[model samples]
Target: MPTYKQFPLADTAEGLTEADILSWHVKPGDTVAVNQIVVEIETAKAAVELPIPWAGVVTELHVEPGQTVEVGTPILTIDVDPDGAAAPAPAATPAPASSAPAEEEEMKPLVGYGSKAVVTQRRARKGAAPAPAPAAAVAAPPAPAPAPAAPRGGYVPLAKPPVRKLAKDLGVDLHALTGTADGGVITREDVERAANGTPVAAPTVDSGTRERRVPIKGVRKMTAAAMVQSAYTAPHVTEFLTIDVTPMMEFREKLKKSREFAGIKVTPLTFAAKAVCLAAKRTPDINAVWDEEAQEIVYKDYVHLGIAAATPRGLIVPKIRDADSMSLKELAESLTQLTETARAGKTTPADMANGTFTISNIGVFGIDTGTPIINPGESAILALGSIRDTPWVVDGELRVRKVMQLSLSFDHRVIDGQQGSEFLADVGALLADPAMAMTY
Candidate 1:
């Protein structure tokens, strides 16, 4: 007899309740091997690829792409014994509406499985017929007009719940509009185009492009929530310092040719990170967390430095583990690898956890400076501004020098104004003269 196996959504990270099915690599009837990646899912924290535990032939897919599935729900089924002898047929019987306890008991938890039973109900199919009424019930009122006919080849459109809601709100019939997505799945953009009476194939400006609305989910949704929590929960105090970083800029040029830093692509941000690490040693309280529930301040001994990187999805901060312990060459190499992994959308949840302090390099985008909100757990954040050539008074002589601005935002409940100002000044001083970092 063939053994049927169901693959449940495992806990990819802590506090992950659900994940969106981004795409499928294997379909029904496809032969798969153990540990082969079969699907990709996007959770609130990161995008992860799931591997099948047992080698088998895919029997059925229980979930569709773009659908959010709760943890522990069966997303796909497979037959482990494809060549096994067929079992004797049973007498004619009606299948139960819900799975039996025997079937549930047969489910073996794979490695990393988070839960045992499914928690979410699958959505009902669009235009499904109502269940038959009891004989004693009165005749139901006449059914409403049937939905607009499906597209060619009698294909009904596939759309997510939000897109369906948008179509209904705009008085547009989804079945009538041709979809531009893969496998005739309707998207929000398709519905908006239909509402504007434009051809779904070609969306042009002539169709009155007033505004475009994007649904927030995944990374964008998580980022929004974190920002709101950080802004409201913590009292923030921002202090700015303008400094001439001419010495630091010159030091970077010399370091580029040194054999110790030969392969590293050194930049101003690299020097800024080094300076922060060195300054953090002098001001250890700056690298701390506010423990609200515990009613105490938690000062960290080491730094898991968070370098904020903006991706196509949203802002993600992947940390460099034990950054204070690494040399400048090691820091530069780790920073390069961490950022490349983050931008490529491969940063894992663990890579983002346990950050002691953060740095937001807004200078990359030509931004001068802004009061950056603190990362959720961390108490302080440093923002680096654009480097420009400006006239400065050096020893009472006006000369052109490389100048940059630094802004530090700290949780006022944990750090006083004096402490925050002193921390910012130390960072500015180190950056203004790279050799000053050694004195600390």
Candidate 2:
């Protein structure tokens, strides 16, 4: 019998149960190396590429692009090698007997470290193995290795690992496709062309809805569950405060050309974020979370400030670590970096963890204000509103200027009405007169 090894999915990050397989990298009969990107899966926060643990000729593709797989379900199979003739085979675990139902089976890697590590196989690093056999010939697998991508032309292009895999799975030549955007780089559309039978239109989706529903697998499934859980568990208290932000508007204009805010987008939210951090500092209780398991309150010393962004998959809050220590310019740059990462689905798991406070800048989407929900584990969140011209009284005279609203949502259990109002007032005061922020 030709022995075969199955490569099951594993939890890529904490609290993650399943991921949506956005795309696959290799097809049946194709040679793959250890650490080679086998698939791209969309998690709640970003799209991440997962590498194959073992090197081998792909004997079967168990899931198609867009299928969601559980954390330990086998998505594909590879032929294992021994004696350096083929790729190292993943260690095998005896299957649970037939009486075990699909849901009852452990949908995870076997828990033991040595004898139970599912998919313990490793592969040869790039350039370490001898050249593969000719395209038409049966080739020996690469040598033993751990998984790891070379940096391309000064920039790692933003495609997910699965996008690269999609090209491979569809037999589409990735290098042949031309980038429609800057520097002529190829995109997902380029590889998708081969999958649809006709050449793909660059940067565009297939005309009309020959709709495809990718099974919600990895991150998407985990994220949806988390959002639903948070929505139900938290007792949300939302309070809105609108202010004449004309002064803040003027402050932003002055900062844009100033050296202190050099090379940064001096938006009201940047100032709002700084204000929130300062306010949280003054109100320690609101900055803390209820650790239900430990039966203790956890107060974070450093702020992992989360910025909520809506991506194609869903809402992802990628945090900016130690945001309190950064200058206005630094915060602006970080915002830009996180936004791009969120859009590309490349923000790592580390980027999404440890958020002590969250800011949902709905202003960018041109909304005035909204009663926002508190992110689970965090006690408070602020919604930054849109700036628009409105008539307001200043020094007993009415004048038209940029005005905006701010909404602060806090956990009522930890934060009283007085404290929540004070925090909101502090954020409003800073925006109304940003020069006042120097005191903190």
Candidate 3:
């Protein structure tokens, strides 16, 4: 007899209740080994690949890709007794008057993880008749409308779990909407079009397409929630300063050419990050968080500096741990790795958590400056503006120099104007003279 086993969705992390199945590596009837990576799932924080615990032949896939399943739900089933010989087929015989009750077996859960017992009941023998439906239920009135025809191959339309949920909430049928995404994968925009009574085959670039509806989830969703919470809860005070950063730019170019920093792409942001880290020590309050419930100021001894990175998913801030202790080269290398990891969507939850300070380099986007909202649990965020050639007075002589604007947004509850201005000025002074950081 073949032993059927179920694979439940394990709790990958604390507070994570569900995950969206991004893709499956194996299908039914495929042989798999123990600890083999079987599927990839995307939680709110990161994408994780799950492994099978026992070697076996895959029997069934209970959940489909792009579906969000809760912890303890069975994702796949396997047959552990694949090596066992098949039993001989039974001969046709006269049916007995009655049969014994089916036996149920409880599946063992994965080690260190607990899940609800998945009971598998034996199927009735082929000759056994199904129990009759209740006569009163059979006589019930028909539904007002005829049931919609099931799609071919029991096809549930391909869509991300969020899109499916959106379609459900908007009273739109996903099966009826044609997907614009690759491989006929339905998107949030498709569901929105259906909800708005727009044609499913309508071109996205058409002038009459009007508005686009984007589903807020993943990093974008988390960022929005955090921004809203920070904006309403913390009294934000923004201060702007325009300074000549010609020296910082020159320092970066010199470092790029030096053999000590050869092959490393040094940018002005590197100097800005170093300046912020050094200046934060002078104004420790800027690196602290306001504890509303405790009514106390929580100051951190170390800085897990968050560098805001914009990815295809959305804006994500992956922090560099212990940035204050790192040398200029170390900081540069860490920043490079952090940014690459963030853009690749491989940034883990631990990388993003426990940020004491943040730097949003908007100069990369060529925008001058804007008031940046504080990251939740952090007191201040520095915004680096575009660097451009501007006329400036140098020793009573008008000269064209590379000037940049810096905007600092701080929580008024934690940092007053005097301390905030001083902190911003310290950072500016360091950029104006790179050697100023050595003194700190």
| Per-residue lDDT value at 195 in model 1 | 92
lDDT tens per residue, model 2, 1-440: 23356677756655555566778888878888877888887655557777776677777765656544556556776764433454432334322343321111121242321132343223323454332333422322222222213344544333334565667677765555655543344566656655677664565556786866443435556567776777787777899988988887787788888977777776676787788778778777778898878888887777889999887776788998888888777788888888888887677777887789999999999999998888887988999889889988889999998889999888887788898898888888888888878887
Candidate 1: tens digits of C-alpha lDDT, residues 347-419 = 9878888999999999999988899999999999999999999999999999999999999999988888988
Query: What value does the lDDT take at residue 392 in candidate 2?
Result: 87
| Candidate 2 runs further than 4 Å off | 1-4, 43-46, 80-116, 119-224
For every candidate, C-alpha RMSD to the true structure in Å? 8.2, 13.0, 8.0
Q: Estimate each model's TM-score.
A: 0.78, 0.69, 0.76
Candidate topping TM-score: 1
Question: Per TM-score, what order, best first?
Answer: 1, 3, 2
Top-scoring candidate (lDDT): 3
Task: Report clash pairs, candidate 3.
Answer: none
lDDT against the true structure, each candidate:
0.79, 0.69, 0.80
The C-alpha stretches of model 1 lying farther than 4 A from their native spots are 85-110, 113-209
- Please give the TM-score that candidate 2 achieves against the real structure: 0.69
